[model samples]
Target: MSETVSPPDRAHPGLLGQALALRAAWLGMDRAPAAIAFAASVKGIVLLYVAVFLVFCATRPGPGSMLIVALGLAGCAAMPARRTLVIGLTTLLFIMLRPTRSEDLSDFLRRELDLVGSIDQRILIAGAGIAFLAFGMAALRLQSTFRETAPGRHPVLTMMLVFFAILSVALSGLLPVEFAAEVWLFLAALASGFWCIAYALADQKVKQTTDPLPRAAFFRPFWEGPTLPIGKGAGFLAKFEAKDDTALAVTRLKGLKLIVWGALLAGLDAAARSLLHTEAGLPVLTDAMAAAARGTPLPAALSWASLVVHYLLDILHLAAWGHVVVALIRVAGYGIPRNTVRPLAARSLAEFWNRYYFYFKELLVDFFFYPAFLRWFKKYPRLRVAFATFCAACVGNWLFHFMGRIDILAVNGVLPGLRAFESYLFYCVVLAAGLILSQLRKRRPKPEDGFLRYDVLPRLHVGLFFCLLTIFNEPIDAFTIGERFAFLFSLFGA
Candidate 1:
């Protein structure tokens, strides 16, 4: 009987059977925790809101003040804020504007700055150029084509080469002046992001830990956000990438939350603009400046409040967009961190700087601060920190902005651009000084420091400083520094 017994037969499944099995496995996550289920539901709602928000905003007509408002929102979202009320109020305005405006959305959108078309073309071309450069560098290093030509071995040289090539393209006359300036600025923006990779490679080479730049990251800056990138380099971002299915799931869930939050913030931005500027009839900075120039100045209190609203809304917009982009990345399995953190709650200038536009700050730190810190200031720790802070907060910051807006200079003439820079220059100097001092005075708060000293005072100081700084930050290109000062002094009855 034992000899006659036959082994049990097994049958193999076909492709369709395997697919069904996969489907069943994927759908069988019923054991996921209650918290995860709740989170997933919330994320779904958020993403839905985000879609509605973007379509509404982008479909609007013309750039005009809307572009400025968009910029303001971008500033807020890209930076950390302590509160959400302003964000909410601003969002409500946009929600209302979208429906009430009778003009055909497509008509307005089609006429958007012709500059936008050129900008897009330039961005793509520049991106392709950078890709070529990156691959060429990678090839040289990988193939040992030239031992001395490796990017890691000659990081500074590699950067310099790219810089000159970009400069040549910008000045090549192959493109129109406006397009050329945009190309230059686009490259500058990308440079701020790419410098981190160069710095990483350089530092690693110094320590014999060099690795090739990830090819996938070469064009990241082009699509990450509109103007400023939230993350710097592939190497840095690689650290945050999800390593497992669980981590990937968590990151995607987080992305959904950000998208929802950003959509809500967009609503707040629209509301703020409606309440403060549209309905209340507060003149925009440009109008206010014009009025002031004509000797019919805005009321001091209103001027101050207007600036605050403008800056707050701008920040909200940036934050909103940043969340959308970052969430998309996270959902794609790259768990890059948020670009901003509680910026409004920052206890110090340095803290605010670090929290706001985090990756931009990182770019400055990687390329400007660290180099100065490590190489030149070893003997004077305080001076070292101050110097490094200046290099980043002032020099790098100013250069980036100036380059980004170089088109303004070219279009309006260099003298006008320089004049416009006066207010910005003053703002940068003050910002640099404050940040430098903050850096030098940085310390861990002791328990004895108390909530008032450690928690309340520092935050208040940061808030006040940023608020005052916003005055200079407003569209002050048309006005002299003297005019801006007079306007500020008028506000305080000085």
Candidate 2:
């Protein structure tokens, strides 16, 4: 079995739940040939990076532009395999700056707006022309290996999409919005590029013909599944249906671990902001928070309201962003289980997460403590599995700072520069404590008194959830949490 999870023929149309709807056969090949998956990922990311950068250079911003181009090209030359290396480099390029001041970069970008001026760009255009000629020949010559044997189609639309995409990203930092034409053109390019890539992935699936992986995911018991010994590898990740259904619970259990952790994360962030007001360059909201933070006077009526609103808003934001990336990854062809938000919708908190961010539940299940439990399960059995699972998850939860929480801290001005890292570390400890305490109190399985029925009631859940979220996490709200939540609820006519 390959790592490809195709859309099942019988996929449920209305499930709307990614985990429920998505099923993949267990891949026979747990490991692909020599980093094949990595290579594909890298290639797409690099091609995407290059495509964007080339367009940026075309704008010819300044002498420094030459340096950015040179480094990017050098990276490409060194990592021609077109795998994780390129994509990681590019994605990290954007991500690594969360705590740093981007004002300078933005100003510099404005200076370098004229990609149309760079001599190097002229050289690149010439090179692209030559490459197009060469690709046409290769298309005709080694058509079998290099080109898909599908019916001849120009895919010019995809090309234009890519062009606009590359241009949009390149110009976004380089120009002022006042230049309406350039901005519009750049956006058009990005939209086109994204569409083309989407088409390309779809085309790959169609052309492969034979289904390499399963149409459904498998759940294996702790003893049954092989130890992946890799990152995020423990979850009920759809590795093409490798094991028995009964042994593996339909989904992983760590889903609740992460969502509760995600919620506790808010408290952690609040503590950081409140406690480190000076280092964070602003006041953090609390009951005692200033009435006039961020130029807005706190409203008395919504003091308690905003706190709840903030938390729910955060949930929606996390869910929305998580799904977007998950979709992009699926469309791009990396069959990472849709482990983000869906798991959080469990009827019961546990079931909700299993349905929501299923991966974390699996992560807590397999990756974190499963290994340790694997050693003793024969002797300890139930106790070992249950105990180790949540413990390992606590440790993983504590480390959440590394993956994401830190960025939120910095962006929200919880901590400035390197301080954000330290602040997040502190918050994670508190969050872990919260998660551990919550886990210690779980009663034996009760019938699923699932999610509040509000979701099915004409989107009342969605509206209320987001309204609360918008109030608390408006990013610019600068209001106390209680106030935000209250303000959001008041907006409802009934």
Candidate 3:
């Protein structure tokens, strides 16, 4: 019997296998009650605070503001029964302490309208307070009276129309300059929180309660980015909120992981910038584009390098900031998805878009794509998809960017502002076309295809497409469409 006995054979795991094993182990902790308890315990909170402080030291999203948010989350955790009230009060305090739009509005008033000291800091604060009150009341009314009903059925479209109407009146020069200036200031306040209010209104349809506190909490919530609703509105937050102590602990642990990951990304971004701009001496993308516009083009190879490096850097920057914001949301006990996923792994244009800037895409789909898809070209399935893609990817994209640059309108008036937006409009059109075709394509890479064709080639094509598309996605308004085209053409030795 001893002679017949043999040891069991075990295969050796390679590097990739080891990595996968580690990832599995990491994920396994999320389901373990002891791990959850540790994450939710006081020790866990203290460790989290230390990690957050270190990360914020590197990234610097205003230490004071971050402290306020941290304390607010602690309060919410301590008073779970009054979480909404805590969130509402916290959001109000955060906005009051760091009013996002007040400084811009104040600067505009002073510089453009020559209203220096006419609208002091106190007035600006008062205006913000009034704007919050008005928008909050409007959200409550919409939720109670018009949830899934007429007029409120398309809250985003309604909001857009009203916004444009006000802007039109302000730009008409029909009213006295002082009144127009006042109107512009009011519009700025509304525009600042426009998307937040729209999200709140949209959530009303699915919500059971018309609570003002939840609506107010979502108005530029402490965890949200400047414009995008990272966790979306109340409906999404409610849906994703931790159901138990264990779940809350897991969510918070995940949040800590994200913050650390984001800090790494921030470091990577800084290192990349140093390598490209300092060590290798690559020109800034905007500056290079401006030089090309002025008939002083960089060498074709250098231009190409600059473009690629800039695109990669932009992705890192976005992903880093988005991760931090989403991490904060998760730390507050909401297990929301990350804002940017692994975009480089995308093998198709639509997939890339979905991964690249998730919340922005969601904003478009919620406000533009679904509405157009449901209401138009119902009989023609393909055309319906194409049209909806156009609405979301082209028209909606254009409008969102336009609204964000309302200050340009104040500075340069309507025509010049529109002219400055030409390049971005072109970018959106090409992007929409690419997305539509990607959606309509029937054949996709399969495993049976060789590894290179099935995996590597598609990713390469997607990467190339997005890289080239960035040629026209210039953020600086100083350059014209012609100049952008010139830079693109010069990349090929034109």
Candidate 4:
């Protein structure tokens, strides 16, 4: 017998039908030729700007110094012919305006370099910008020229070795204080733009790569995102650039949608913060940790509540910021993926890591995992996978966080700074083990396993694993590894 299909309204009644209808309307506008044309028109651009401004005001108390630059880049990006030149020039301008991401670097320069009156800070920063650009250009040239050479074949590894060599020398104190300070400043610039340069160099090996200027431009791009290279290098963006007006319009509409969604997430984050920390009178995680360190801990129930709430809020905060950055890139006509996806929905630890911070995970996989996998343990499949996981999740993860705290290494002695990373080091090791097991497991939950087994149990296990791992994910110099263990035990009244 033939079965009869329900009408759309009958299938999804009331509010559900209305939601589906709205989504269908959006999809229709997203594809219709006339709608696309209108979206790419001047009036559409103006509307986008107005909407962005309103969202900015609603989300951010201050729109930040790079807002104007970001908006200008978005406008210029709409004109495909001038996009490359505009991006290159604006990136140079941004570097001149703000040379380094870390404010602590400025303080380090003043105190360690003794540049308080010897030279203007602006001049020094400008000099750093010039050095960075020149170095980036030379690196690109080296990669292109020496593609067959060992250094060119593995630029990321070479760069890391060189960076650490210089860092070691600067910290060795063998050179005069003044000269060492100059070296430290150069190191700061290199560290800030390290991954960008790596991505650019990596792109050079590709058959069709961007020009050196545009490639270098992505080193601290006009969007002023975190040092993680959110959209990656020029080659990655080139693949996603809109080819026609219709595509551009669709991309821009998606961008606007992302911005609005990001703004909503931001608002939700703020509301959650206020509700948990203010309304409910729960202490911040850091404050709670500090209290625990001081031999006074909150009740175990409260501690667990704080931990769970903090984890959710942290995901929301990262997603909000990442969405804004990706949206701006999309507006500029490059349809890159969002930096954070549905991490909470992830059913496995490895999957959670992939969803939680995509760009960072990609960075590790590209720079560390691929290299090790291709080179070592080729005859042993499990060993290869485990080794690659170790390289990426443990070694690369630790190095990335350690590089981010370079200013701390400069301020405190190298030994002290290394000690500060002890807790994070433990975190990385355990994370690698968990990820390795997750990847190696032969069987996975399936539909036949039932809802509780297939859906609920795996997610709950993943959540608890990550939540407990948070104890060791302390900031630089926040707590000792032993103290973090103590706090972890306290959660169970041990």
lDDT of 3 by residue, 29-97 (tens): 667777777777888766765665567556776665677776666776677566677777777765554
Q: Write the per-residue lDDT of candidate 2 for residues 191-310, one digit (tens) a residue.
A: 212221222233333353222111101111111111111113212123422133211111111121222333444445555445545464332234323443333444544443445444
Q: Evaluate model 2: give its lDDT.
A: 0.35
Q: Which stretches of candidate 1 lie over 4 Å from their true place?
A: 1-213, 221-223, 412-416, 442-456, 476-478
Compute the lDDT of residue 236 as modeled in candidate 3. 79
The Cα error of candidate 2 at residue 216, in Å, is 28
How far out, in Å, is residue 195 in model 2?
Answer: 30
Candidate 4 lDDT, tens digit per residue, 1-494?
99998766545468988999887876577677777787878897767656665665566643444465555556564565577777777678767655666556555655654633477667777777778778888888877777778998777788889889989998897988767777777777777788889989888877544358778878866666766889888888989998887787788778878887889899899999999899989988777787688788878888888889888899999999888878878877889999899998888899999999998999999989998999999999999999999999999999988886787888779888899999999999999999999999999989899999999999999999999999889555788887777678778986
For residue 131, give model 2's deviation from the true position in Å. 32
For model 2, the superposed segments whose C-alpha errors exceed 4 Å read 1-301, 342-344, 352-367, 376-382, 402-494
Look at candidate 2 and tell me the lDDT of residue 277: 51
Give a tens-digit lDDT track for model 1, residues 1-494: 35777888888899999999976643443234543453345464345334433533542424532442443334323331311222233323322222112122212222322444545643444453454345434643543333355654556556657665775566556888555644543444344334433544544454443334332233232223433445544455556766654554566556555665666677787888888788989877666656666666788877777667766676787677666667555554457888777688778888888877787887778777887788886998888888888888888777666644544554455567678888888888899999877877748555589998988888888888887787777664567887777676766755
lDDT of each: 0.57, 0.35, 0.78, 0.81
Tally clashes: model 1. 34
Those runs of model 4 whose alpha carbons end farther than 4 Å from true positions after fitting are 1-28, 32-34, 61-64, 67-71, 102-116, 208-211
| Candidate 4 residue pairs in clash (backbone atoms < 3 Å) | none
Scored by lDDT, the top model is 4
User: Using Cα atoms with residue i matched to residue i, what is each candidate's TM-score against the true structure?
Assistant: 0.66, 0.33, 0.89, 0.91
